[model samples]
Target chain A: MDTKAYIASGILELYVAGQLSEKENLEVAEYAETYPEIKKEISEIEAAVLALSEAAAPNKPLSFEAVKNRVELSEDTKLIPLNRGRNRWLPYVGWAASAALLAGLGYFYNQNNQLRSDIKLAETEIQALEEQIAGASDSLEKTTALLQTLRDKNVTVIPLGGQVAAPEAYAKAYWNETEKQLFIDAQGLPEPPDGMDYQVWSLTLNPLTPTSVGLLENFQTDENGVFALSNPNQSQAFGITLEPAGGSESPNLEQLYVLGTVSS
Target chain B: MQLEELVERFKQKDLRAFEQLYAMYARNICGAINTIVRDEVLAEEICQDVFVKVWEKSDAYNSSKGRFFTWVLNIARNAAIDELRSKSHKNQKLNLSADYFVGILERADDEPNGNVNTDRIIGFIKNLKQKCIELIDLIYFKGYSQKEVSESLDIPLGTVKTRNRNCISQLREHMKQN
Candidate 1:
């Protein structure tokens, strides 16, 4: 394109004047972009026009803020969100902080209520244990009275000695002939290990046979160290052995902790 | 850095950009309205109105259409013309002679701070033929197209562009001198 001819064509002057049609205006805009000379010429023309128009302005200067207010009013009518940072207000700041604090308080209150319920649950568990201790002490007194009855003059006391399996273990049996009850004191034996408990048996010496009695269910936890057994058989001797928890039908001879004969 | 970039920011509702653009063209816009209205108070009012209108209708401006100043110029001229044609102005004593910009230049001679000297402008304006003034007044100030200017000035169809070029060149020389 002949840049000089385009410049001399005077379209740039009208371009500055804004008198050109849309198509012509776009063409001029393209030329202005492609050629610096065209752009310079357009600027010069615009500068000249600007000076002329400005000289024609009234002597009095108008307020820029008054015009800005009108702009703001129109913006409000259009519901455009204004930049609040440029114009600050105290109420907006206060309201924002209040909302944040409200949300934080609501979260803290919920956590507080949960902690209160947990504390209540722990208090209830402590009260229930106190009742169980009181019941255990009451049962110990009744057991002591039964022990006193067996130690009478008609009772037979058998001294059981520890056998080869456990020489340190010993036991004693108090037999009551009339009542047909036997109380075994196995305090000389150690507590059975986990998954196993001590079983007692009554023996008849003539047949050399042993009969199952009962297992000491609370051998480890029982404080008194005495076990009550029913002796209905005509037994001349009694033996105590460590059997399985449910008790065996016959005494475990290898596991026999003690043996004694009842003197008639 | 570019004027279009500045105007685009203004369209996006950038206040700093708007203020810069206002500072750049506010005087020219006010001057243009004052030339037609001839009332300083009314000119200030219309100038502010024109700026408000510019901001409100910022989306309507496209660089391909014209310069930013030209777009603002069109707004100021239209607003001034509308005020002139309104019922309030129509009933008043229309002081037609004092309304032209040349009258302001003539009256400024008596004031101490009148930077625009009438003799200098008239001398520079003399370089432009009588036809140049009529074409400039119609096309630039009145927002008339070549066809309209040609019909108004009784000029031939082909001469409007060349004549306007000559008139603008004279004004450009006058601006360079001051």
Candidate 2:
């Protein structure tokens, strides 16, 4: 029999663990008896376990006298000192250890709490990241829709030039005639005052009439200086004007920031 | 004397042989018992009783049952489990980490629980892996079968034997070093 193969099988360790069946135990024992190398390996494994188990033995004076006194069968009565073993605990010392056990228990309890808090912190971080991802996806969807609208064949691009009120201001209007929708990119325009907003007007040059489109609501805080407004009338020009917060019923000619006419 | 020879003598009811066997195995047997009972005094008491029973049932112990120490370990574990069940109403909650015998050695540096030489034992097995600690605890101390350990730990059944062998090899290496 290959003793190395037998030792590597871990049967001897299981034998020492006493988890092997009786038949298996008999086979292992027979192998050990036959193979000196297998026998040595088995004993070494047993010794390591013996050392570990001995480490858990309580600290007490070992005297065979204590056990000898208890056993009276006496094939021959001879007292010998227990030379090596560390023996078991004394009663009082074992009892006193209850307090020490409590202290150990408290330490483990605190460790458990710390681990729980760590998990909670990790879960909170995951939730915050999830919220950020959701916000990003929402913005991505809105931008995609705006891109599709701007690229539509029915849409007309109208460039707006800076007016006398604010020569530096420039804006562009994207008009999708089929859908009666207008998108204004006012990236070059300055932010409106706290109590005021910029409104777009659909103007017909023949009558010199201006129809209120919609206010550029929340323009100061809007990172994307883009707005969508409805324009149903046949308009020759588009103008943006700064008005009081809600938006004015008509364009404030003095505050006209930009003026643009349809290229068509 | 060789362990086999001592066992042969012990079977013949030789008082010297019995004393030698008890002295050889008593500490390890008691320590193994304490891991279960978690009570040193009770474990010591059980250890004494187990030795007496081992003497009484000496003829029944055979090579087929395993090594002499394994037989004693079986008796000690059964007695400890019996007592634990009777006293289960007293709130003896055991956590996975702290209840293990290895836990004692690992925690022995600062907290003096279990045996006096535990810190020394920690020195011997300081570099031991967590998997090794768990395998040793379940197989040797808890008396779990390889299949039971595999299921409980959710490891492949074949891994149990090989892992335990490696762990024992590591332990032997540590012992040889220290």
Candidate 3:
């Protein structure tokens, strides 16, 4: 009945160390739940042990990525039993042959249906393969086009570093002065909040006049986080701001994420 | 405890939850393994494998059985022991010295920046008795049962529990003073 005596008995330490039997552990767990002080004492014991063991660690903890990959791989291995289950069907055919002649015809008919289903499965698998090949080609073409745009000599590369709101935010403006087109690499930018899109701007210094280039629409669907927009302004600098989905008529100076001056 | 919630999430195969638990206990688990295997590289490898096994066998864990740290600590010890008994370790004939956790701190003057918190553990170990270190190492680090500890330390069966109590009280006191 005395909590102090219970705490001093040191059973709680053994309980935390898992030295107690199942019955003893359950009793301790019950007592801990019944008495808050018991629970606190248990935690303190655990904390002390944890500190001692942690100090013996030889190196920093390994990242969880390795653990995750191995665990997921084992998870995937479970699905493989489905195919192994199919192989058992072949052994059944041999047994059916020895069982009786009358059963042979029925077994053949069943095997015919199984073969038909297998053919259907193979056809669907081929369709999946075709779709994958088509998807890969589509991405390859897009990558080639993106590379061409990046390599174009006329394009001016403006590095827009992160702003105060999002310190990690980054974007690049690849402007083609002759074509009046700008490609904005907003890879470093986080996704705009719902109903918000990042809008680009062309700024002229001295008077500090700002002109809207274009809004980066369908930001989510745009792969590679690169958007191409028309910019037809003689500007000394470029800036990007977050605006409503439809975009604002002017750049919101307060939301300006990245800004860079055009160096002649 | 909030850790119970994290353990529940871990049982549900939440990787983020698993990561949170790992960060909390990895050092302790790895340290325990290192204490047994006495090989930093091998202990690290086994420590990682223990976590992966824990993830695969998460269904085997819950509060009713024991503390999550206790469960993990057992796994780490068993894994490190297995490594010690394996052929490679046998050929090496590792002496498997009786160096307890405090020994790491005692030897820290030689390697000041060893992965361990030399300053903090030194402060803790400075006032700790040799008996306290040995008892904690046996029951806590080595995963020895009370009966085993009693036999190994030649202490009376009745005294093991209370003796460990006093020893841990000293540790808690040291922690408080620091």
Provide TM-scores for the models. 0.54, 0.53, 0.56
- What ranking of all candidate models by lDDT puts the best one first? 3, 2, 1
A30 in model 3: Cα distance from truth in Å?
1.6
lDDT of 2 by residue, A142-240 (tens): 888889889999999999999899999899999988899999999989888789899999998887999998988888777577898888979889999
Which 10 residues in a row give candidate 3 chain A its minimum summed lDDT? A53-62
User: What docking grade does candidate 2 earn?
Assistant: acceptable
Task: Give the whole-model CA lDDT for all candidates, comma-separated.
Answer: 0.79, 0.83, 0.84
Residue B53 of model 3, lDDT score: 92
Which parts of model 2 are misplaced by more than 4 Å?
A73-264, B89-98, B106-108, B111-118
lDDT of 1 by residue, B34-121 (tens): 8788777898988998999899888899876688898899889889988998848887664433234655654644453545543455
**Reference-based lDDT, residue A162, model 2:** 96
- Cα deviation of A124 in candidate 3 (Å)? 53
Give the interface RMSD values of the models in order: 2.2, 1.9, 1.5
**A-chain TM-score, model 2:** 0.58
Best by DockQ: 3
Chain A TM-score of each model, in the order shown?
Answer: 0.47, 0.58, 0.59
Candidate 2 clash figure, as a count: 0
Candidate 3 residue pairs that clash: none
lDDT of 3 by residue, A96-200 (tens): 767777687788999999999999999999999999999988988998988897789988999998777667888899999888889999888889999999989
lDDT of 1 by residue, A32-61 (tens): 889999999999888767766666667666
Query: Candidates 1 and 2: which is better by lDDT?
Result: 2
**What TM-score would you report for chain A in candidate 1?**
0.47
